[model samples]
Target: MFSGAQLSLYPMSDDFVGIITGALSALDPHRDHLRIETDDLSTLIVGPPEILFSAMRDLFVAAARSGTHCVLSATVSRGCPGEPDDPICTPAEGTLPVAPLDERIAKAVAAVKAAPETGQPVACQVSLYPLGVNQHMDEIEGCIAFLKASGVFDRPKNFCTKLSGDAGAVFATLQQAFTRFGAAASHVALDVTVSAHSPTRA
Candidate 1:
């Protein structure tokens, strides 16, 4: 299976360039673990799920620490058909196997509870698509149940679910949503947007 994300960070300030460049350092710790490439549009990170989300959290937190509003847009996927399988995209050790819907939900909730706190808080909205599956709705609803119980869940939006909390748990929940709902080898994708230090609040 191939897993990766195409991520773009946007800082709402005149120093966007500086903020973005400085935040790139946050990816240093994860560099050896992932295949990272940057271009004019976005950065591509390919690796295990745990490392992928952690790297993203670090980068976003770094930029947000500047007290500037920052938004991260990413398209994350696993088992993509067009992509060749790479050993680097291997699943984490002891990753949960596909199980009954209820079992997966319980485990996902436990993961969120166990996530390490990163001090920085963020708000994320995401939509999951489990393609080419007859039980797609079941998978989606199962993910919804998991999110509501994740502690970071904020609310349900029109087309996606909203989550807010420490960056760690929020990203953990996102990882769970990506990995747990779909079939073990099926194509699953997530459209996610995360924000920090936004001036406008509800």
Candidate 2:
């Protein structure tokens, strides 16, 4: 089992460099916890699913706090061949051979909940890709219904769902969505772009 992601960040402003640097700086503290490599195009992070998602949450939130429009694009994968055969990429007994999406989501939600509050709501946009699953649309629709009923989902935007609320509640909803869908689907991949401090933030 191996889990990793290639992430690219784009800050839609003239001060893009500053925003990018800020996000990288935030991730610096977690370097000891992950295997990270940065190139001109993207940053590759490899580690346990929980740690990867936690680091991503912190990096994205720090960038969002810059008060600029920022987008983080990531292609996440697991069980890749030729990856380092280390504990970080190894699965424990009784868990999926690939990265466990449910656990990853729980860890990500915890990270979001632990983030410092700014007296304003935070928002995140997410798209879930459940690969090799039958009746995928039905599962997606069910997840959407759960998100809406949870009251954290703001709306559906183009290819993703917008979630806004107190950070804890919003993240909890995310955890629920991932857990439910992941359990029903064979393989789940998520593409997420979050704005911790939305333009509407007070």
lDDT of 2 at 74: 78
lDDT of 1 by residue, 1-202 (tens): 8899999999999999999999999999999989998899989999988889989999999998998899999999988999998888888764437799999999999999999998998999999999878999999999999999999989999999999999999999999898888888889999999999888855
Model 2: CA > 4 A from native = 79-86, 90-121, 135-138, 149-151, 166-180, 183-186, 196-202
**Cα error of candidate 2 at position 68, Å:** 2.3
Q: What value does the lDDT take at residue 38 in candidate 1?
A: 88
lDDT of the candidates, in the order given = 0.92, 0.64
Q: For candidate 2, list the clashing residue pairs, or say none.
A: none
Query: Residue 197 CA error for candidate 1 (Å)?
Result: 1.1
- For this target, which candidate reaches the highest TM-score against the unseen true structure? 1
Q: By lDDT, who's the top model here?
A: 1
lDDT of 1 at 182: 87
Error of 1 at 200 (Å): 1.3
Q: Residue by residue across 70-159, what tens digits does model 2's lDDT show? A: 667777665444554557644333245224444444444554456444343567787877667676786677666666666567889899
Model 2 lDDT, residue 177, Cα: 50
Q: All candidates' TM-scores? A: 0.97, 0.68
